[model samples]
Every structure is written in structure tokens, then in C-alpha cells.
Target: MIRAASRRGIRCVFVQGEDVMEQLKELIRYEPGINLEPVPCRCSECNGELRKVEEGEEAILQDKSYVPMAKIGKCDFWVCKTCGRVYWQGSHWRNMRLQLQRLTKSYH
Candidate 1:
């Protein structure tokens, strides 16, 4: 598959992993310089660029239910202009960071 893509002037990577974290590790192993750290620059659901939701601009969200009401004014928010999906660094964000750190240490 990779060879076929290469013939067509495209680059491809074959990643082997049972889950997302493992897949990320494999990607890093394939390319040591790749940045695995989370960045809110793009939407996870779609490849759309994300725009930071400024304070008082929360009303732009089409689906408010995706966000916790209590966190509205407490944390930074990013919205996908194409899909209108909201993103925030909630509790799971810490766990993801920890996992990335472990993955990085294993490689370095």
C-alpha cells in the first residue's frame, strides 16, 4: 500500500497499534521529530481549523450542550467553524498529557 502511494507521488505511513495511544507511539517512532502534544489548532472530528472562542463569544456555539455550563467562563474554549464542535481542556486532558509524557520518555 505504501509503495503504491509512493508511486503516485504520495507519502504514507504504516502504524501498528491496538489503540490510540499505542498508535501515537508508533507514529512517533516512525518520525522522532513529530510533535504528539495536543494542540487546538485543528478539529478532531473534521480537519477544519479551530478558532478560539473568546470571552462573551460563547453564543456562537450552535450546540451548547457539548459544554458544561459551570465551565463556560472558567476555561478556554475552541470551536470548529466548519462543524461547530466545541473543544475544551477538561479532566481527561491531564491524563492525555501524562500518557504523552510516558510515550516521549520511552522513545528518548
Candidate 2:
């Protein structure tokens, strides 16, 4: 399949693994410049650009239910410009950053 894609002038990085981290590592091995570090720059749902929800701009979210009231003043919030999906750095973000840090150490 990779050969077929290459014949059509396509670039590909083959990765196969059950573990998500392993697969990501494999991808990074082939594409060294790819940034695996977690950053709230794009929407996970639609790949839309994310803009930080500035102070006094939380009302633009439209759906208030998605906003975590407790984390409002605790962390920065971002909203997808296209899909309006809200994002915040919670526990998962820390875990992902840790994994990426480990992956980065292996490269160094």
C-alpha cells in the first residue's frame, strides 16, 4: 500500500501498534519534526483553529453546559472558531504531556 501511494507522489509514514503511545512514537520516528506535545491550537473534532476564550468572552460559547464552572478562573479556555467546541487543560492534558516528554527523552 505504501508503494502504491508513493507511486502516486504521496508521502506516507507507516505505523502499526495496539498502544496509542507506541503508534505515536513510531510516527514521530519517521517524521521527526512532528510536534506531539499537547497544545490547544486545533479542534480535536474538526481540525478547526482554536482561539483562546478571553476574559468576559465566555458567553460566546453559546452552550454553557460545556464550560466547567470550577475551572473558569483556574485554567485558560479555548474555543474552536469553526465548531465552537470548548477545550481546557485538565488531567488528561497533563498525562499526554508526560507521555510526550517521555517520547522526547527517547529521541534525545
Candidate 3:
């Protein structure tokens, strides 16, 4: 055990983890649910405002010269106008949206 004396003449005792539970339990409080705010459509990387990709900028979405042949799909996309980062509802982003839905529903 380590011992130390304070200037106020109080004996401060260091208690091990096993001996401190009873004294600490009353000060803890638990809440049953969490509160969440509305999800904003911003850049996941930089949180910058996202703008729709404009005409003639399709090259920014993918490397046209190197991209392999792919099946067709349509998804609404938003890109960060500042950093030029693209955002699309891939599986991970969709999963995060689902989690947000579950949390808001659970809290309500």
C-alpha cells in the first residue's frame, strides 16, 4: 500500500478495488435508453456539406479508364464539394442508417 499525507491534516487511505464497491455503488446512476439526434447528410470523412455530382464530373465517381465492366445500378449520390469525396449508400452506410433507426425507435 502507498501512503501519503495532505497539508489539511486528513488521513487519505488508498483502498484496493475489492474493498471499494460498497462506497462507490450509491453514486452511480443508470439510464435505460439513449437519445439521438437526426442524421445529417454530410460527408462521412470530413462532415462537410455534400452536393450532387454535376454533369461532366462522372470521372470523379470512378476511374473511367481503369474500371472493369460492371452491372448497372442506380443510387442517389452526394459528394463533398470541398474535398470531392463521394458518398453512396453502400452496405455499411445502410447498416449505420438501420442502427440509427433502431436507436431512435428504442428511445421513443
Candidate 4:
């Protein structure tokens, strides 16, 4: 589905004056679903349970500003409690989503 969106060039744009970091943070917030559960620092990719290393750390966004709130980074990917596989916000997220949006728009 994501790849399909990319082929059609569908893109997501933030509202005017909406900071990308804030938007990204909102997207990164947790939502409950069958495959996901709010758990302690656990690596999403490796499935290795994580231990809290820090309460939160600041993240720098592409717009050259820090995210308003502290974000957690995992030492390893799989079980990093801060983020799981289903939803991850990183440097590449925007670019990757833009391409994928095109692929997704085909159905729309």
C-alpha cells in the first residue's frame, strides 16, 4: 500500500506555521492496536527488551530546530522502548514518506 502511494506522487504537507518537528512528534505518539502495546524500553526490530537509559533526549529535525519535547533513542533498534517497528520517526522519514505517498495515491 505504501509503495503504491509513492507511484502516484501523493505527498503530505504540514499546515502553514506548523513545525515539522511538532508534526513528527504528534505522528510518533502512541496509538493502541492489536500488534502494539505500550511497554517499557523494548527494541522493536530485535525484540530485545530495553532498559530505560534516559528519560528523554532532544532530537534535531530537518528544519534545523529541535523537537519541542524530549525524544528517546534506543541503543539498538528492535527493542528500543521509545519507538517500535510500526512507527518510527527519523531523519529519513519525510523523504521516504514522500516517495511512498506517490505509490499510495494510485488507489485514491
Candidate 5:
């Protein structure tokens, strides 16, 4: 799932495959004045931090306006130090969340 991408001065690996597989391969444009930040989280494969991406910059979409958010996954999935892959909620996350809710239900 490690796709090639660069952020700031750090060369990062992004997760590949899934809904928008092609999007993962797309590189984000860095603006000279933009302030980017690295997404701190565990990689789906190896639980590593995703490479830092310059904030304030936008990803140019074909036949559309600039994409403000990094559509890595649902929420933000960071890359891992080992596997160098990104991870986040795919499609079954809602079911997982519901299970958690059920488990954490309080006594009425």
C-alpha cells in the first residue's frame, strides 16, 4: 500500500489500493508560502507515521477546483516507519464503530 509521494523535505510513502487507488498515486502540489504538517498516526501495514505534508497547499484535481483536504482515506491515515504505508477507515469502519458503541453502552 505504499505509494510514492513527497512532502516538505521528507520523502513519504502513501497507501495504495481501495476506493480511490489512482488518487493515492497523485502527488500534491507544494506552494511556497503554504504551511504543511505531517499526519501523525499508525500505518495500516506497519503502524508508522505518514510522511509530513506541507499544509495550506492543495491537490489539483482534473476538471475540478483544488482539493483542500488530503483524501487519503476517511479521516487522515498516516504512514508507518517500517512498511511506509498509509492506513485509515475504509468501508467497514462504521461497523467497527458501532461495535465499540455497543460494547461501551452505559447502564440506563
Candidate 6:
């Protein structure tokens, strides 16, 4: 048998998106510091690792105007090494964080 990701230098992992979301809420269901830390680094759009790209590195930004750079902090830039999507934390990110916080708190 063959797998698409096993062709050469590729790798694969299985994730039940909803499953983890549920688990995070379940595992830290009533933890107080749940909101003190930032979310894990992964492509929100594709769940890929967000690699740090130095200046002059090439990347295809899906939307040039919406590079949400200030939502997280300074040096707010990363690229999804798998899908080539660029990201910067901004307003939408704050909203998502708040929602996740609510989820973690509501478990009590």
C-alpha cells in the first residue's frame, strides 16, 4: 500500500479538528491559566506549522492587505510552511482568543 504523504519527504498526522477542540475544552475545562497563554502555533486555515520566515524570504500571502501583525505582538509574521499561507495576529485573532477563553471558562 502507498500513501500520498509517504511519497518522499512528506509527513502526515491525523487530527479530528472538532475532537481536539472538544478535548482542549474538556482537559482544561476549569483551568484558570487557560487564557494566559497564546494558542498553539498552527495554520488556522490548514492546521500546518507556522514557520518563521526571515526578511526577503518568499511567500504567497493570500491577502496582502490583511496581514494581521499586531494582534499577537511585535514580529508578528509567520508562514504556513505547508500551504504557503501567511498570517499575522490581528482583530479577528483577538475575537477568536476571547471565544476560546469563554469556552474554557464555561466548562465549569
For residues 41-95, what per-residue lDDT tens digits would candidate 6 score against the true structure?
Answer: 7887888898766665533442455554333335556778788677765666687
lDDT over C-alpha atoms for residue 16 of model 6? 35
Model 2 misplacement above 4 A: 1-20, 30-36
Predicted candidate 5 versus true structure: per-residue lDDT over 1-108, tens digit per residue: 323334345554343446432322222222222222222455556655555323432222211232224463225433345754434444455665554344334211
Candidate 1 has a TM-score of 0.71
Which is the better candidate, 1 or 6, if ranked by lDDT?
Answer: 1
Q: Tell me the tens digit of each residue's lDDT in model 4 across 1-108.
A: 445656789543333337653443433332111122233344646655565333333222212233322333533122244442223354465565664444334323
How do the candidates rank by TM-score, highest first?
1, 2, 6, 3, 5, 4
What number of clashing residue pairs does each candidate have, in the order they appear?
Answer: 0, 0, 0, 26, 11, 1
CA lDDT scores, all candidates in order: 0.82, 0.84, 0.50, 0.38, 0.38, 0.60
| Per-model TM-score versus the true fold | 0.71, 0.68, 0.47, 0.25, 0.34, 0.47
Candidate 6 residue spans exceeding 4 A from truth: 1-23, 30-36, 55-75, 103-108
Score candidate 2 by lDDT.
Answer: 0.84
Q: Which candidate is the best by TM-score?
A: 1
lDDT by residue (tens digit), candidate 1, 9-93: 9766788798988888788888877777776887989868898999779686535776887788888889988998899888888
Judging by lDDT against the true structure, name the best candidate.
Answer: 2
Cα deviation at 107, candidate 6, in Å, is: 6.8
Q: Which pairs of residues collide in candidate 3?
A: none
User: Of 1 and 4, which scores higher on TM-score?
Assistant: 1
Instruction: TM-score winner between 4 and 6, please give it.
Output: 6
* Per-residue alpha-carbon lDDT of candidate 3 for residues 1-108, written as tens digits (9 for 90 to 100): 133345566444443345323222211212224222323367768867888656666666664333222411355456786776776556665676666555445545
lDDT of 1 at 103: 86
Q: Which digits, one per residue and each the tens of the lDDT, describe model 2 over residues 1-108?
A: 789879999898888977879888888888877877677897989988999999888676545786777788778889899988899899989998998888888886
